[model samples]
Target chain A: MSFDIALWLVQDGVTNGAIYALLALAMLLVFAVTRVIFVPQGEFISYAALSLALLQAGRLPGVVYVLVGGGLVAAALDIALALREKAPARLPRIVALYVLVPCVMAALAWWAAPRSVGLPLQVLIVLGLVVPLGPILYRVAYQPLASASVLVLFIISMAAHYALTGLGLVFFGGEGLRSEAFSDARFKLAVLDITAQSLWVVGASFVLMFALRLFFEKTFYGKALRATAVNRIGARLVGIPAELSGSLSFLLAAFIGAVSGILISPITTIYYDTGFLIGLKGFVGAIVGGMGSYPLAVAGSIGIGLLEAFSSFWASAFKETIVFTIIIPVLLWRSLRSRHIEDEEE
Target chain B: MKHRLFTALALAGSMAAGSAYAEITIGVSLGSTGPGASLGIHYKNAYQLMPKTLGGEPVKYIIIDDASDPTNAAKNARKLVSEDKVDALMGSNGVPSAIQMAQVAAEAKTPMMVLTPAILSPAVAHWSFIVPQTTELMMGAIAEQMKAKGIKTVGYIGFSDTWGDLVLKATEFHAQAAGYKVVTNERYARADTSVTGQVLKIIAANPDAVIVGGSGTGGALPHVALVEKGYKKPIYHNHGTVNAEFIKVGGKAVEGAVAVTGPLIVPEELAANFPTKAMSLDFTRRYEASFGAGSRNGFAGYAYDGYLLLNAAVPEALKKAKPGTPEFREALRGALENVKNLVGTHGVYNMSAANHNGLDERARVPVQVQNGTWKLMK
Candidate 1:
C-alpha cells in the first residue's frame, strides 16, 4: 500500500479503535466492580442507536417500554427486600429508582417523541433511555446472584445477551438502521479527507476517557467504588455499600455504551444484534489489557482496530479470523509472563 | 384390545376423509422473525393480499416462522406436508432455506414456491418453482448496463455466503464475456458494520464500476463506505437488493447506484404495450392500498407472482384430481410446469418442463436510484 493509503488506514483503525477503547473501559469497570462480564453491554449500544433511529423516523421508540418494565421489576425486587428487612427508610429511594425515574422518562419520551425534536435532544433522550437500563439490568438479573461464582455469572451474562438480543429484535425489527452523520464536513488533510464524524468519535472517546479518569481519581463515590473493586468484603466491612458500587459501575458502563452507540451509529448501519460483536471486540481488548489497566486496554484496542483494518485490506474474507487470532498470541504471552495465584475463599 | 383397534381404525378413516374434503391449504415457511424478517415480512404481506380462494374452493394458508434457519424450514415443510396436509408449499426468504423446503416438497410430491432467486436443477425444478429471476438472468441485465456505459473494469464486494458466491460468479462470467475485467473481489459477512477496508482495496484497484452483491439493507454498507471515502465510480448492486428497505437504509449514499431488478419494481411506468404492465400495476395497487403509498416492494411482487402462477394451475389440477390428495398435488405440479403466457406482477411467466423460473429479459430490468426513487433505465 502507498504511504498515504497506509496513513488513511491507520486513521480509520484509530477511529474504530476509539469506540473499542470505550467499550473496553466499560468492560473493565463493570468486571472490576461487579465481577460480571457485562455481556449485554453491547445490547445497550444497539438499543441507544435504534432508539435514535426511531426518533429520527418520527416513531416512538420501544426503549421507553423496556425502561419502564425493567424499572418496575427492579423496583419490585427492591421493595420485596426492603419489606423483608423491615427497612421502610429505603422505600422512597426504591420508589424513586423504579417508579419515578421510569415514569418521568417515559412521560418525557411520550411527549417529546411526537413533536419535532432536534438531534441533540434526541441523542440525550436516547442516552437517558439506555443508561438507566444497565443498573436496572444488574438489579433484575445479576444483583440477586451477586454472591454467585464467576462461572455462574458468566453463564447468566450469556443468557442476558440472548434475552437482550431478542428484545432488540422486538424493539427495532431485523433491518439495520443508520442515522444522519453528526457532521458532514470533510477536511482535506494533505492526501486524506478526514470526516467530521471521525473527529467527533475520536474527540468524544478521549474526553470520556479523561473524564472517567478524573471521576475515579477525584470523586468520593468513585473512591468508594474503587474500594469495593479492590476488596468487596473489606469495602463492606469499612461501610462502603458494595451494592451501590455495583450499580454505580454499571451506570458508568451504560453511559460508555450509549455514547459509543450514538457515535458509531452514523458511521455504520447498526442492526438489532450489531452491538454483540462490537462488544465482543471490546471484551477482547479488555482481555488484552489483562482486564485491569486502562492504558493497556486503550493501547490493545488501537492495536486490534489497526490489525482489523489492515487485515481487511490484505484479506477481506479472513479479516475476522485474523482479528480474532490476535487474542491467542496475547493470551499466550500473558500466561507465560504472569504468575499463578491460588483462588481466595471469600 | 380388539374394540380399541377397531375404534382407532375408524378414527383414522374419518380423519382421512375429513382432510380429503377440506379447503386447499398452501403451507408457507418463511424467515419471519430473524435476519431474513425484513424481506420475509414483505413476502408475508403480499401473500395476505392474495385471493382467498381459487377455482371456487376455499384456500387456507398455514404460515410458519422459519426464523431464517434451514433446519426449521425443513421441519416446517415436513409438518405442513404430514400434519397439515397442505396441497402445496411456499417458502423462505433465502436460498439455503428454500433449498431445504424444496427437498421436503420433492419427497412429499408437493409443489413448492421459493421467494428468493436460486439455481434450480431439473430434479429440484420438478417439485419447486422459483419466483425471482435467477442470478445469471439478472447478471445479463447488469452486464448489459455496464457495457452500454462503456465500463471496462469492475470491482466486486459481496457477502460471504451462497448468495454472494452466486452473484460474484455470475458477474465474473457475464462481465468478462462483455469485456469487463473484474479487478478485485472482496467478501464480508452480511452482518458486518463496516466495509471500509474492502472499499479502500477496491478504490486502490481503481475499477471503473463497483458491484456489491448483497441483499436487503446489508448491501448498502459497502456502497456507503465507498461514498464516504469519496470514491466517484459507479456502483452496481444485484437483483437481491430490489426492495424499499435497502433504499431506506442506504439513504443518500446510494442515490446514483444502478441495480438489476425485476420489471415489476416499476410496473406502472413501463410502456403501455408492455405485457406484464397491467398485472404489475394491479398487484402494486392492491399492495399499496393495504400497505400505504410507496409500500410496494419487488420482494412482495415475487410472492404475488407465485400466487398468480398457482392460481392459473390449480383449476387445471382440480380437473384431474381433488385438492387435498397426493395425486392432486402431483397434477398441480404438472399443470404449473405447463403454464405458459400467464402474466404476473413480475413478468409473463412461461413455465415449461425444462424451465421452472419461466422468465426471460422481460423479467430483468436495469433501474437506477435516481433522486431516492427507482428510475427504470431506458
Candidate 2:
C-alpha cells in the first residue's frame, strides 16, 4: 500500500477504534461493578441507533414500548421485594425511578416521534428511550441474581444478549438502517481525506472518557461504585448500597453505548445483531486489559482496531479469525503473568 | 355403546377418504429471523400472496423459521417431510441453509424448490430444483455490461461465505470470456461494520470498476465505502443487492450504482412482447400492494416463480398418484424436470434433466439507481 492509502486506513482504524474504546470502557465498568460481563451492551448501541433512525423517519420507535414494558416489570419486582421486606419507606423512590420516569420518557417519545423534530431533538429522544433500558434490565435480569457466582451471571448476560437481539429484530425489523451524518464537512489532511463524522466519533469518545474519569474521581456516587468494585461486601457494610452502585454503573454504561451508537450509525449500516460482534470486539479489548484497567483496555481496543484494519487489507477472509485468535495468546500470557487469587465468592 | 362405536368408526373411515383428495401440503423453511431475515421475510410474504390451490387442488403451506442456520433448515425439512407429510418442500433464502434442505429433500425422496441460487451436488440436484437464476447466469449479465462499457480491470469485494465464493467463481469464470482482468479479490463478513481497508486496497489496485458481490443491506457497505473514498468509475452489483432496503441504507451514496437483477424489479419497463412481462407486472403489483410500494424484491419473485413451476407440474404429477404418496413426489420431480416454456415473474423457465435452474439471459435486466429509484437501463 502507498503512504496515502496507509494514511486512510489509519484514519479508518482510529475512527472505529474510538467507538470500540467507548464500548470497552463500558464493558469494563459494568464488569467491575457488577461482576457481570454485560454481553448486551452492544444491544443498547443498536437500539439507540435504530431508535434515532425511526424518529428521523417520522415513525414512533418501537423501543419506547420495550422501555415501558421493562420498567413495569422492574417496578413490579422492586415493589414485591419491598413489600416482602415490609419496607414501605423505599416504595415511593422505586415508583418514581422505575415507574414514573419511563412513562414520562415514553410519553415524550410518542409526542416527538412525528413532529420531524430535527436531528438534535431526535437524538435526545432516542437516548431517553434507550438509556433507561439499561437500569431497568439490571433490576429485572441481574438484581435478583445479584449474589450468584460470576459464571452464573455470565450465563444470564448471554441470555439477556439473545433476548435483546430478538427484541431488536422485533423493534427495528430485519432491515439495516443508517442515519444522516451529524455533519457533512470533509477535511483533507496531508494525503488523506477524512469526513467530519469520524472526528465526531473520536472527539465524543474522548470527551466521554474524560467525563467518566472525572465522575469516578470527583463524584460521591462514582466513588461508591469504585468502592463496590473493590469489595462489594465491605462497601455494603460501610453503608454503600450495592444495588444502587450496580444500577448506576449500568446507567453510565448505557449512556456510553448510546453515544457510541449515535456516533457510528451514520458511518455504517447497523442491523439488529450487529452490536454483538462490535461488542465482542470490545470484549476482546477488555480481556487484553485483564478486564480491569481502563487505560489498558482503551489502548488494547485501539490496537485491535488497527490490527483489524491492517489484517482486512492483507487477508480479508481471515480478518475476524485473526482478530479473535489474538485473544487466545493474550489470555495465555495474562494467565501466566498474573498470580491466581482464590475465589472471592468462596 | 357398541352401536355408537361402530357409527364413529364408519364416520372416521369416510372422513379419512374425503380428506385424502382434499388438500396438498407444501413445507416451507426460510431464515425468517436471523442474518438473512431481510430476504427471508420477503420470501415468506410471497407465500401469503401465492394462490391457495395448485392444479385445481387446495393446497396448504407449512412455513417454518430456520433463523438463517443450516442445521435448523435441515431439521425443518426433515420434520416437514416426515411429520407434516408434505408432498413437496420449498424454502430458505440463504444458500447454505437451502443446500442443507436440499440434502434432506434428497434423503427423504421429496421434491424441493429452493428459493436461493444454491449449487447442489449432482446426487441431490435431481430432487431439488433451484428457483432463482444461478450465479453464473446472473454474473454473466454483469460481465456483458462491463464488456459493453470497455472496462479492463475490475475490483471485487464480497462476503466471505458461500455466496461470496459463488460470485467470485462466477466473476472469474466470465472474466476470461469477457476479455477483462479481475485485479483484486477482497471479502468481508456480512455483519462487518466497515470496509475501509478493503476499499483502500481496491483503490490502490486502481481497477477500472468495482463489482460488489454482497447481498441484502450488507452489500451497501462496500459500495458506500467506495463512493466515500472517491472511487467514481463504476460500481456493479449482482442480483442479490437489488432491493429497496439496500437503497434505503445506502441512500445518496448508492446513487448511480448499477446492478443486474430479475426483470420483476422493473416490470413496468418490460416490453409487452416480453414473455414474462404480464406475470411480472401482476406479481409485482400484488406484492407491492400488500407490502406497500417500493417493497418489490427479487427474493419474493423467486418464491412466486417457484409456485408457478409447481403449479404447472402438480397436475401432471397428480395424474400418476395421490397427493400424499411418495410416488406423487417422484412424479412431481419428473414433471418439474420436464417443464417447458413455463412463464413466471422473473423469466421463462425450461427445466431439463441436466439443468435445474432454467433461467437464461432473458431473466436479467440491468438497472441503475436514479433519483432514488431503480431505473431500467436499456
Candidate 3:
C-alpha cells in the first residue's frame, strides 16, 4: 500500500479500535466485578443505536417497553425478597427505584420521542433507554444465580444473550438502520482526510474510558466494587454489598456499550444480531488483556482493531478468521505459562 | 368396538374421495423473521395473490417461518413432506436455506421451487428449481456493461460466505473474458457495521468501477463507505439490490448505481415487445391491487413465478395420475421438468429435465437507481 492509503487505513483502524476499546473496558470491568463474562454487552449497544433511530424518525422506541418490563420483573423479585426477609423498609426503596423511576422515564420518553428534536436529546433518550436495562437484566437473570458455578453462570449468560437477541429482533425489525452522523465534516491530515465522525468516536470513547478510570480510582462506590471483586466473601463480611457492585459494574458496561453503539451507528448499519459479533471481538481483546486488566485490554483492543483493518485490506475474505485467530496464540501462551488450579469442593 | 369400526369406514371413504378430488397442498418455508424478513415479507404478500384453486383442485398453502436458519428450513421441509403431506415445496428466501430444503426435497422425492439464487448442479437440479436468475447471468450483464462503458479495471467487495464466493467467481469469469483487471478483493460479514478498511483498500487499488456483492440493506454499507471516502467511480451491484429496502437504506449513496435484477422490478420501463412485459405487468397489477401501489419488487416476482410454474404443471400432472398419491407427486415433478415456453412474471420458462431454472436472458434486466427509484437501463 502507498503511504497515503496506509495512513487512511490507520485512521479507519483507529476509529474501529476506539469502539472496540470501549467494549473491552466494559468486558474487563464486568469480569473483574461480577466474575461473570457479560455476553449481551453488544445488544445494549445495538438497542441504543436503534432507539435513537426510532426517536429521530418520530416514533416511540420499543426499548421504553423493555425498560419498564424489566423494571416490573425486577421489582417483583425485590418485593418477594423483602417479604421473605421481613424487611418492609426495602419494599419502598425497591418500588421507587425500579417501578417509579422507570415509569416516569418511560412517560417522559413517550412525550419526547415523537417530537422532531435535535441530536443531543435523541442521544440522551437512547442512553436513558439502554443503560438501566443492564441492572434490570442482572436482577432478573444473574442475581438469582449468584452463588452458582462459573460454568453455570456462563451458560446463563449465553441464554440471556440469545433471549436479548430475539428481543432485539422484535424491538428493532430485521431491516438494518443507520443514524445520521453526529458530525460529517472532514479535516485534512497531511496526506489523508479524516471525517469528524471518526474523531468524535475516538474522542468520545477515550473520554468515557477516562471517566470510568476516575470512577474506579476516585469514587467510594468504585472502590467498594473493586474490593468485592478482590474478595467477594471478605468484602461481604466487611460490609461491601456484593449485589450493589454487580449491578454497578453492569450499569457501567451498559453505558460503555450504548455510547459505542451511538458512535459506530453512523458509520455502518446496526442490526439486531450485529452486537454479538462486535462483542465477541471485544471479548478477544479482554482475553488478550488477561480478562481483568483495563489498560492491557485497551491496548489489546486497539491492536486487534488495527490488525482487523490490515487483514481486511490484505485478505478481506479471511479478516474475521484472522482477527479471531490472534486469540489462539495468546490463549496457548497463557495456558503454557500458568499452572492449572483445582476448584474447591462445594 | 362399533365406534372404531365406524371411524375406520369413515377414514376409508374420505381417502377414496381425496384421491378423486385432491387438495394439493404446497408448503412454503420462508424467512419471515430475522435479517431475511425484508425480502421474505414481499414473497409472503405475493403468495396471497395466488388463486385458491389450481388444476381443478383446491390448493392449500402451508407457509411456515424458517427464521432464515438453514436447520429450520430443512426441518420445516421435512415436516411439510411427512406431516403436512404437501405435494410440492417452495421456499421464500436465502440461498443457504434453499440449499438445505433442496436436500429434503431430494430425499422425499418432491419438487421444490427455490426463490433465491443457488449453485445447483445438474444432480441437485433434479429436485430443486431456482426461481431467481443465477449469479452468472447477473454478473455477465454487469461485466458486459462495464466493458461497454470502457471500464478497464474493477474492485470487488462482498459477503464472506457462499453468496460472496458465487458472486466473486462470476465476476472473475466475466471480467476476465472482457479483458478487465480486478484490482482488489474484499469481504465482510453481513452484520458488519463498517467497510472503511475494505473501501480504503479498494480506493487504494484505484479501479475504474466497483461491484459490491451483498443483499438487502447490508449491501448499501459499502456504497455509503465509498461515497464518504470520495471514490467517484461507477458502482455496480448484484441482483440482491433489487428490493425497496436497499434503495431506502442506501438513499443518495446508491443513486447512479447500476444493477441487474428480474424484469418485474421495473415492468413499466421495459419495451412493449419484451418477453416478460405482459406477464410481469399482470403480476404488478395484481400485486399492487392487493398490497397497494408500487409495492412489488423482484423478490415478489420469484414467488409469483413459483406459483405460475406449479399452476401450469399441476394440471398436466393430474392428466397422468390422481393427486394425494406418490404417483401424482412423481408426475408433477415430471411435468414441471418438461415445462416449455410458459410465460411468467420474471421470464418465459422452458424447463427441461436437465435445466430446472429454465430462464434465459429474459429473466434478467439491467436497471439503474434514479431519483430514489429503479429505472430500466437496458
Candidate 4:
C-alpha cells in the first residue's frame, strides 16, 4: 500500500529469506555429496532452538539424550560392520567420535544446565549437543543406504523426519518456545523501524554463506567433498573416501541448521514440527535453483521469502498455497531447458 | 508365587462384585500428542483430578490419544463405543477432532461431552453436548468491551482453520450490534513461524484495535508482530488464546493484550457471589497443585465441567436402565438435554433441547496481560 509499508514488508521478507537461504544451502550440500534429500534437516533447526531455550532456562535439554542415543546406535552399527569386515582398526575412531564425543557433550550439558550459565555459553553448549547429531544421523540412517536409489533415500529421509519430530515432541513438550532476542537495538530506516534481531539473522546468514564459499574454495577437504558430489564412484576411485565426504557434508549441514535455529528463534515462535514447513520452503528454493546451483538457490530462497511476505499481505489465507505453487513453473522451465539424460544409477 | 495367587483371588472377588453392580465406562478421545497437544494434555490432566465416581456409581474413563487428527478421533470414538462398550463418550480439545467424535456419537446414539465448542449438524447436536462456551458468547464479551471503550474499528487475524472461521463469523456477528466495523480478516496457519505480512496489512488498514482468532501458542505470533511493528492500540483475543503458554511465548510484547476467557482462569478475581466461583477456586487449587503452579488453563476446566455435567445426568439415566446398555445411553442423552443449573468449574451449565453449551455472560471474564500474567480487567 504505502511506500513505508512496502519497505517494512521487504525487510521482513529478506530477514526470513536469509534463514531459508541457509537451509537451502545445507539441503543442497547434503543432497549433492550424499544423494540424500536430508528431509530431517529442519528437525536439527527445531532441536537446536528448543535445546537453546532449555539451556537458557537452566534445564537440561532433551536433545542431550537424543545425541547420546543416536551416537550409541551409530557406534553399534559401525562396530558390527567393522567386526564383520575384520577391520579392527576402524573401531577406535568409531569409539572416539560416536561414543566419546556425545558422552562428553552430554556431560557438559548435565553440568552446565543447572548453573544458569550465561547466554553465550548456553549457545555454545547447545551447538555442542546438536551439531554431532548430523553425522550420527548420516551414519545410522543414510550411510547404509548410500547406494540406494534417490526414491528410497527420500523415503528414508521422510521417516527420519517423522522420527525426529516425534522425539522433539517427547523432548520439548507441546508448547512453542521463543528465545530472548540477541539484541534489543532498534533503529529507524526512513519510515521503517528495523529490529536488531533481523539484522543478526541477515548478518549471520551472509557470514555463514561467505564462510561456506571460502571453505569450498580454499580447503582440501572441501575439494574432496566437491569431487564426491560431482561423481561419488569417481571420487572413491581417486581415493576420496565416500563415507568421509558424506559425514563431512552432514557435519557442515548440521552446523548451518543449528546456527539458523539460534538466529531465528528470537524472531518467531518455534514448535516441535515447525522446522518441517520451514525446511519445505527451503526445498522450494532449492527446486527453483534446479537443485544444483548454490548462488541461484540463495537468490531463489530470498525471492520466496519476498513472495511469501507480499502474498500474505494480499491474500493471507492462500499465502502458503501461493508460495508452494511457484515450484511448478520453475520445474517446468528447468525441465524444458535441460537436456534429457540417462539415470545416474543406471 | 504366593503374591500372584493372592492377587488372582482379589481380582476374582472384584470381578464377582463387578457382575453384581455394572461399572459406568466413559470413553475419552483426546489429541494428546500432536498439534493440539498443548490443550489436550491439560484436558487429560483434568481427568486425573476428576472424581472417581459419577453420581454415586463407580465410573471408568478410557482415555485414548488421537494425535490431534480428525480421522483418528472418529476411529477412536468408534472403537470405544463398540469394543469398550462405553455408555457415553467425551473427548478432544481441537474443534475438528471434536466434530468427528460427535459424528460417531450421533451414529451410535451415545451421549458425548465435547471439551471444545463446536457447531454440530442438527443430528450430531442431538448426541453431543458442548462443554466450552460458544464462540458467539465468548466473542460477545470482546464486543461489549470494545463498545464500552468507544473503539470504532478492529482488524482481525486468526488461524486458517474452522476455529478461525468461527471466530471471524462471531466477531462480524457482534460488530453489527456493537456498532464497529471489521476492517480486515487475515488468516495464518497454525504452524506458521511469522505473521509479518498479515500484520503489515492490518497496520495499513490501521483499525482502532486488533483481534487475533488463534489458539494456544500460535495466537502469540500475530500479537507479537503487531507490537513489534509499533501498533500501540489494544489487541483483543478470543477465549482460545488465554493461556500461560500464550503469555510465555508473546513475552513483554503482550503486556497490554486483552482476552475474554472462562472465569476459571482467574478464579480469585471472581466475585464471591459468582455461581461457579467456589468450584473454580477448588479446581484451580487442585489443578495447580497437581500440575505445578502457573499451569492453570481454561482447556482443563472444560474437561472438569464435562465430567460435572455427566455426574449430574448419570443418576437420572441410571434410574431407567443399567450401565453398558444402549437403553441407558439413550436415557443419558435424554437426561443431559434436561440438565439445569448444574455448577462446574467454568460456569453453571443449563442444557436444553436446543442449546447444548448453556453458558451465559457470567461464564466469561475480561483479562489483560499485566506483568506477564493474566489479571482480571476490572
Candidate 5:
C-alpha cells in the first residue's frame, strides 16, 4: 500500500502543499493588517521568482543579494513615499509605497538584463523584491486611505497587480523562462527520479517558512505587529508604532513570497502572470485556514497543494475541475452556516 | 489607448477599399489581440505572397480576432462562416483555441484550416485540414528518430495543460510502441516555479533519456533544474520548447537536448530555383524584420503557409469563375480542392475533397539546440 502510486501522490501533494501554504501565509499577513485582498500579491511571487533566477544565474553570493535587493527596494519606497505628503510628519506610511515601482523595476532590470544573470538568479531577484512590496504599499498607501472604504483599497490592490503584470511583460517579455537552478543533476530509481536541487529547494522552503512563523510569533516585532492587527489605535497609544508593524508584516510576507518564487522557479517557469494563479491559490489557502491565522494559513496552503496533487494523480484529466468544484461546495456550506448563525443571533 | 488606435487606423486607411471581388467573402478568425496576434502579420503577408507566386486573382479576405479565448474563438469562427459569409476558414495558434475553432468550422462546413500543433479529436471540417507537422506529428518524428538511435528508456515532464497532455500521450505511445522503456511521467501546475522534485524523480528512475513535452519554456524547466541538482541525461524537446528565450534562460543547460521543428523558414539559397523561388525565404526575412528574433516558432511557419495556400486558391477560383456571375463564388470553392504540390514553408502543400492536412513526418526536421542557436539534427 505504501508503495502504491496513491501513496506517492499523497507524499507529492504534501510536499507541494507546503510550498503553496507558505505563499498563502505570506498573503494572510497583509490581509490581517489591511482588509484589501491584494490581487497584486501574485505578481510579487512572479517578480521574486524572476529576481531569484537573475541573482542565482549571476552567481551573486548566497542569500545576501536577495536580502540586499529586497531591502534596497523597500527603503527606496519609504523615502519616495515620505516625500509625497504635504506635511511629511503628518502623512501615513501606507500611502507612500507606490514610490518603489521604478526603483524595484530598475533594480530588477539591472540584475536580469545587461548583467545577463541566469534564470535561477532572475527568480531570486523577483522573489526578493516582491517580499517588501505588499508591506511598503501598506505603509505608504493603506495608512492614508484608512478612512476610505474597502472598495477603494480593493481597487488599489487590483491596480497594483495590473501595473506589475503589465510592466513585467513589457520588460521581461511574455514567454516563461527556464531557470538554470537545475541543469545537470540526476539519480534514478525504478520509476522515480529525484534531483538534489529539487530536494534542496523544497527543504529550504520548509525550514524558512517555519522559521518565519516563529519570528512573526515569538519575536518582539512579531508581537507588535500582532498587537497592531488587533487594536491599532491602542497599540499606537502604547507606543507600538502601528504603521511600522504593518510595514513589518508586508515585508515579512514579501520575503516569504520571494523565497517561494525562488524555490518554485526551477519547476514552474517564471513568467509575468505567474502570480495570478499562485496569488489566487495562496488567497484561497489563507481563507481555508480561517484568514489572519498564520498557522492555519500554512495548514490551508498545504491542503490546497495536496488536493491539487491528488486531483492530478487520480482524476488526471479533471484536476482543475476538482479543485474549483470542491472549493465551491465547501465555501457555500461554511458561509451559509455562518449566515444562519448570524441570523439566529440577530 | 489613442496611440494604439491611431496606429491601427493609419495602417487600415493606407490599405483601405479592397478591390471588388465576386467570390463569397470568407471570414478568417485568429488572435486579434495580445501576443498570439503576432502571427496575424504572417497571415497578412501570406495574402500578398499568393498573387505573384500562384497567379491567383484577388478574393475578399476577412480576418477576425478571437481575443485569446477558446469560447471567443468559437464565436469568431461562427461569425466569420455564418454571418460574414466566408467561403472557408482557419484559426487558432495552439491546442486550446484550435479545439474550439475546429468545432465551429465543422458544423459550418467552412473548409477550415487549423494552423496549430494540436491533434483534432476527430477531424473538424467537412473539409478541415490541420496544418502539417502538428505538435504530435513533429514529436512522433523525434520519437521515431530516437527509436532508430536505440535510445529506449525515457522520462517525460511538462506543465499540466492541454498541449502538455498531447505531447505526453503522443510521445509515450510512440516511444512505448517502439520498444522503449517507460520510466517517469510528471506534470506541474502553470504557476509552479520549482519542479526539481519531479525532475529528481525522473533522475532517480535513471531513464536512458528524457522527453520534455510542454509548450514554450515550461518544457525545458526540468532540464535546467535537473542539471543544477546534478542530473545528466539526453533530453528530447518538443517544438515550443526549443526557442532562443528558453535556451537563453536554460543557458549552458540546453546543449545536447534534441527538438522537433520544421524548416519552414528556409534561406533563399535553400529554396528550389523554381518560379516561386525565394517565396519562403522572403516570408521568413520579412517576418523576422518586423517581429523580433525568436518570433518564428513552429506555429508561425504553418500560419504563414496557410495564408499562401488560401491566396493561391483565389487565383485558381478566378480562372474557373464565369465573370459577372453568382456562380463565380461557387466556382472558387470548387477550384480550392485542386491545390497540390504548392510548395509552402514546410513542403509542397496538398488538399483533396477527403483530406485537409497537407504534410506528414517527411516534412518535419528535428533540430538540436547547441549552445544558444538551433542546430539541425545530425
Candidate 6:
C-alpha cells in the first residue's frame, strides 16, 4: 500500500493494458456487428506475431516487407474466405467460420517457415494483419450471412480462436516468443533513462486508442455503426446500410486487436495460448465498462490493469486467485446497482 | 533374345539398386512444443546428428509427438517402443515424463536414454538411467552457495505449474536448510504480462535479494521490472534463466544477474582430460551448425549427455546378450554402473546406478549476466 509501485505499474500496465484493450475491442466489435463473440481473436494475433518473427529473422525485407506480407496475407485470407462462403446466407455462420479461419492460418504457417522476422515486430505485424483480416473475412466470406445469428458468429469466433491456438503450437514449437523494441530503436529522454522503444509503445498506444475513438465518433460510417448497434432494423429502414456498418464494426474491432498485440509485444513474450488469457481479461474489461459503452471499456481495461498492478504489489504470491475472487463481488455489485437504477427508473 | 534379356537385367538392376540400402527405423518422442521444447530441439539435434553409422551400421530416428503430457508421454513412449520398434530411445526430458515413459520401456525391457532433469533423481535409475544433472541437486548447490554468501533473505518466484512447483519446493527446502529466509514474491501463468506489482512487493520487503526460478520472456519481465525499478541486490536466477535470447528481451537490465548454467557456456578448463570432452565439443559444434543457434542452457547439455550415456550402455549390454536375446534390460542395468567421466556440454557425467546424475559442483559453472551476455563468475 505504501510503496509507489505506480511508476512501475503504469509503465508496465499501460503497455500490457493497451494490448488487451485492443484485442478485447476486436472481440466486442465482432459481437456488436455480427452478434458473435469470437474466441479465436488471439489465434489471429499469434499467427501475425509468428509470421512476422519468421519474416524479420530471414531474407524477408524490413518492416515494409513484413507489412506488405501482412497485407497480402490478410487480403488473400479475406478473398479465400469470401470464396468459401458460397452460400453464406444458406449455410450457418458457424460453417463459414470453420472453413475460413484454418485456411488463413495454414497460409500464414507456410509463409513463416524458412524465415523468422524477429519475434516482437512480427507480433505487431501479425496483429496489424488480424484487424484487417477480420473485416476481410466478414465482408467477403460471409457476404450472404449478414445479420443471421449473433450466437452463430460468437461460436465461429470461439472456434477460430481455438484453432489459432493449435496452429500456434505447430508453428512456434511451444516456446515463448518475444521482441526487443527498446534496443531496436534508441533515443534518450533527458534524465529518464528509457529507450525509444518504450516511449514509442506508450505514445503509440495512447495515440492509436485516440485515433480509433475519433474514427468511431467523427466519421459518418461511425454514426452508421452506432445506429446499427443501437437499432439495426430502424437503421436499415432509414437507409443506413446496417450490413455495411456491421462489417465496418468488425474492421474497427480488428484494428484494436492489432494494436493490442503490437503494443504489448515489447513487454511480454507472445505465446499461442496468450490470447485466451488476454482475451478473457479484455472481455471482462469490456463487460465492466457496461457491454455497450465504448468509453467504459477503455476505462475498465485501465482500471483492471491498475488493480492487477496493486494485486501484484501486495499479494505477489497467489494474487491471481485473490484478484479473480475479488472480481466476483465487484461484478455482482455493478450488476445489482445497474438493476436497482433501472428499477427506480421503471 | 539378347535385347530382351538385357532389358530384363536392367530392370532387375534398377530394382536391386533401390533395395540395396536397408531402411533404419527409430523413435524420437520429445517435447515438440511447450516451454521446454527449445531444449528438446537442441538435444534431439545432437542425438540425431551423431554418426549413426559407426563402422557401416545404420540408424534411423522417427520422432513420436509426446505433447509433454504425462499420459501422452507414456502412450507415445509405448508406441515408439512397440509399434515403431525403435532400436533405442532418447529425448524424454522431465522426471515424470521420463518415468512415465520408462514404465513402457521397462515393460518392453528396452533401453531408453532419459533426458529430463526430473529423471536424474536417485529413484529414476530403478527404471531408466539419467545422464543429466538432477534439477534438485543443482538447486542444492545453488542454495548452499547462496547461504555461504551470507545472503539472509531471498525473493522466490516460480511458474506455478507442476514442474515449477517441484523446483520451488526443492529450492525452499534447500534454501531453508542453509538458513536463508525465502519470501514468496510471485507465481503467475507463463503468459502473464506485468510482474512489476509482484516485483514491487518483493522490493518493499527489502529482502537481501531475490531468486527467480522461471526463465523465458514471460518469466523475465520480473527480472527486467526489478532492473527498471533499480533493485540491485544480487539476483540469483535459475538455470536456463540466462540465455542470448533472454538478454535480448530483458536488455541490459538483467546484466549481472546470477545463475548456474550448464558447463558448455563456461570457459573450457574444468574437464581438461575427460575422454568425452572433445567428442561433446564436436557434438555441440555440429548441433549449432544443424540448428543455426547455440544455447548455454542445461537442456542441451543434459539431452546430449543423456543420449551418449544411453548409447554407451547399449553396446556393452548388447555384447553380453545372447544374439537376438530379449536380455537388453539386464545388459543396460549392468552398463549403468560403468558410465564414467563422459564429457557432455554441461559437465563431466560419471553416472552410477546409485547416482544417475553425474553433475557435481565442478560440473555447474556459476555465471552472471554482464552487459547483455553471460560472463563466468570468478
True contacts kept of each: 0.56, 0.66, 0.66, 0.66, 0.34, 0.70
DockQ of 4: 0.74
Residue-level lDDT tens digits of model 4 in B213-277:
99988899999889888899989999888889898888889898889988889999888898889
lDDT of 4 by residue, A1-346 (tens): 8887789889989998998999999999999998899899999889999888777777899998899999999999999999999999999999999999999999999999889878898889989999999999989999998888888999999999989999999899888988888889998878878889899999999999999999999999999999988888899999998889989999999999999889989888888888889988999988887799999999999999999999988999999999999988998998899997654663
Model 2 misplaced stretches (Cα beyond 4 Å): B1-22
Model 3 chain B weakest 10-residue run by lDDT: B240-249
Q: Pick the candidate with the highest TM-score.
A: 4
> TM-score (0 to 1) of chain B, per candidate?
0.92, 0.95, 0.92, 0.97, 0.81, 0.83
lDDT of 1 by residue, A11-113 (tens): 9899989999999999998888888988999998899888888888888888888899999999999999999999999999999988899888878777788
* Native A-B contacts reproduced, model 6: 0.70
How many clashing residue pairs appear in each of the predictions shown? 0, 0, 0, 0, 96, 32
Q: Report the candidate with higher lDDT, 3 versus 4.
A: 4
lDDT tens digits, residue span A45-142, model 6: 55455445445544231223333344455455555555687644534453344344444544453465355545654554465445556555564444
Q: Candidate 2, residues A1-346: lDDT per residue as tens digits?
A: 7787777778888888888889999999998889898999999889988888888878888888889899999999999999999999999999999889999999998899879878998888889888999899999999899888888999999999989999988888888988889999999888878799999999999999999999999999989999998888899999998789989999998998898888889988999888889989988988877788999999998988898998999999999999999999999998899999754563
Tell me how far candidate 1 lies from the true structure as C-alpha RMSD in angstroms. Answer: 4.7
Q: Write the number of the candidate with greater lDDT, choosing between 2 and 5.
A: 2
RMSD, one per candidate, in order = 4.7, 3.0, 3.9, 1.7, 7.1, 7.0
Q: List the residue pairs that clash in candidate 4.
A: none
What local lDDT score does residue A123 receive in model 4, on the 0 to 100 scale? Answer: 88
| Interface RMSD for all numbered candidates | 1.5, 0.9, 1.7, 1.1, 4.7, 2.7
> If ranked by DockQ, best first, what sequence of candidates would result?
2, 4, 1, 3, 6, 5
lDDT of each: 0.87, 0.91, 0.85, 0.91, 0.63, 0.63
Candidate DockQ scores, in order: 0.57, 0.75, 0.56, 0.74, 0.27, 0.45
Pairs that collide, model 1? none
B151-263: candidate 2 lDDT, tens digit per residue: 99999999999989999999999998898999999999877878999998998899999999998788999999999888989999998989888888899999999999999
Per-residue lDDT tens digits for candidate 6, residues B35-148, read: 455455555556656666421335466776566666778888888876776655665755567778777767776666677665333344465666666667667767877887
Structural similarity to truth (TM-score) of each candidate: 0.93, 0.96, 0.92, 0.97, 0.73, 0.77
